[model samples]
Target: MKWLLACIAPVLLAAWILFLSAHGPASWVLLPGILIGIACAAGLSFLRSFSPALRALSLTLYLLPLGLLSTYRASAFSVSKDFELGALPLASAPSEMSIAQLPTGVTYRSAAFGYRGGSLFEPRVFSMTAILIKHPKGDLLIDAGFGRDIAQHLATLPLPFQLLTRYTLNKTAREQLQSSGYDLTRLRAIILTHSHWDHISGAADFPEVPVWIPPAERSFVQGEDVTTATARSIKSLHIEEYRFDARPYLGFAESHDVYGDGAVVIVPAPGHTPGSVIVFVTLADHKRYAFIGDLAWQLEGVTEQEERPLTQRIADFEPRLVREHLAHMAAISARYPELTLVVAHDPRSFASIPKWP
Candidate 1:
């Protein structure tokens, strides 16, 4: 046991140093990784004391270079910079004002599935979706894609989830929003569907914009589930929480009117996470667009009725009132053919929408 500790102590120390150097002392993003690594080292060392085979297997597992190959293969795809920045193929352009979908930034498919039981072989893959919305008032970003640093972080560590290597922030969503004629200073507000790392990475990009977060998600972001740096970052933002109100949009429950004029509506759709939400945008001509974040990985979840199994879904994440709110969205989408539902992280759906400036 002592020998094993001596061998792993250096590796752990090096990881800690690297983490601090990259993000500073405030960076606690890798806390989970550090905890898991230490636990594994301790458990394996104890086991090695009893069995030589266990010791050999532990050493071999740590030495394996498969994680690097996985990261490389995952990051192979490139995001398209030149997406058609206009309306959908079927929708007619509004004659009053130009309503276009702009790709503020692009995201790539990461290995789906978040950490579970500390096993890399687990077949779970969480979807990574990002969107940029350009309104006459100002440019609004739905969710920020995973930053480059996160991909690099995942590559070296044996995290259970896939790293989004292919997706690069070709231009920060902030830049795209600015080019689209939206001033960050005047930027009315930024709404996060949830506080997951992928969705909130770009929050730093819009520090000035008042962020609207779900009340349920407040605890998660403020709690130990997130890194101290991340929590602090979230705390620094101007955050407002909305009670689930299923009154607006005709049967959709639990939403906050971002602009008050009904231009953008933030709806609570919890299942994937406690504070999962959907952003609803109403164009000049009263056309509606729903930015549903991670309700389903692909559009198929909403389109083909293929959602995660009931057992796998988060039940206590959102209160019963919030769950009913999600049902309202489903029902409204079914009834309103004109209302466009945007699924965050789906490449096909993102491709179908017009890119932002």
Candidate 2:
């Protein structure tokens, strides 16, 4: 029994940390839980050096936290229930309001890393794709994926993150646009979902083009946050900070209607980052899409309402806020089945959009 408890304590503690990392209100809350879990596991192991009765009682106490963590991890969010979002907003999308996807690169990850209650054995391909939204006013590029300096950008990340992340680069957004003879003048601004390194890496390639971002995200880029370290490293980025008006749209409290045509609307969905946003684009065919940047890594996060597991602590500025927005987006998805929720990394989510030449 002593030997059994000694070997299992460390294993159970590791599992507990992974299972409960993002379950608390803030990311900081995870540290206490981890420290306590480690202490408890160590205490149990130490107890095993004494009487058999004491060892049994300590083992029981240690198992309690792991059991609790397992139960919490398995629990579902409120996204399971139906939500009312009233009628879809009226949109007068121009016939020329077109959209296409630029396949930049891909990163491989386990399904379990993306969300709670996912299969550990299943490998998922996460696309580093950029979106091109063309309008008569000016075309907008959303989330520049995989730049020429991707290697350098990646190196800026922590060593552990670099070791875990395995990616393949296909084409940078700039190369695709230039190769296709796309007129640079028509491209007005590059609107970012957030200023994360992966999403903003290709922005450096388009030095002349202004990168449109919300005020919050702009601060994130300029601030001393370690997460935005890569973004700050890029010297050529021209940021145009935009603000949201008091107008409400589709359950969101604030919205910025670009082009004043209701064809392109942006809403603050901060959780992934202080400046993270969801872009709603309505094409001429009346087809609508919501580009939810890193809100959930996969379609299942919206369809099934599963939040990120341990990655939320590293990926999200506020995990609780992320969960809240995920629930909201899930509700929105349930109300409008036709609306395409394009998750940033989920390659399958970009199926509807035509590929760039």
Candidate 3:
């Protein structure tokens, strides 16, 4: 144990410094990667009973980014077979108002102001998009895009935060909604799949509307879970009590039909966040779309069966859960080839999708 601690001190220190610089001293999100670093440092100082040769080998861990990438690519997370679940319970009644009933199977209005992130050579566009769902009863928005004054707000954050995850927006959701002449009052609620910074940042614009959050996600902001703690940047949470019934779709065994209309179902696939969800929108045209929230930044990640490297602590909390979720998504995609798997941040899919009126 002493040798192991000594060996990886470089990795831990590097991770700790980076996390501290990005999040600052007071951020509780620092618990995961930073705690081990402090513990290891204390161990080295107090114990000092390890071989120098083992330490050298562990210090080389950072030098081998290829090895790190390979380990991430070699996903070893397994789903629990013992966990039994049933298919979604029978709908109380057929949904009277489904996408099929709409003019062209629901109008999906996406206020997308995307940015090209990652590397300059292989930059992938990530859409900071807010989707407005129009139903007869009321209007609902999913995942608020960058809100008004986003630039000013971001400018207030740390320099490392801005540089590491550089966000460039073309338009804010509030700007888009206003320019499009959409009525804000009609927006009865905002459905948040998780409480990640990007997902909830723009929610500040909808103070009047109730924000629907899953049970686990509600606890995340309340600082209950250390492993998956969300930065309490946004507040005024109005959690909606919805039931997640047992149901199977492409082998996934639990889902909640939000409106009791089998068409729009919320599948709980927690990994990116404790309460992350996959929103399924099945239209009458036989086109089924799964709006997977940060399950992967792009659909290719699922189709290729890969995840982002471990060094990324800003978005993901559990690598094991992410690996298992990706495997399930891959299984579903392979089993049902016709269905379109939409990634929340994939700019390609966002650009191609039609807008609602």
Against the reference, the lDDT scores of all candidates come to 0.51, 0.81, 0.58
What are the TM-scores, per candidate, against the unseen true structure? 0.57, 0.83, 0.68
44-138, model 2: which lDDT tens digit per residue? 65774767776666666566555534532545675343444668988999997899999899887756667776664456788899999999999
On TM-score, the leading prediction is 2
Clash statistics: count for each candidate: 19, 0, 4
Candidate 2: stretches off by over 4 Å: 1-72, 79-84
Listed per candidate, the RMSD to the true structure in angstroms reads 11.6, 6.6, 9.9
Which pairs clash in the backbone of model 3? 87-246, 87-247, 87-248, 88-247
Rank candidates by TM-score, best first. 2, 3, 1
Ranking by lDDT: 2, 3, 1
| Candidate 2: clashing pairs of residues | none
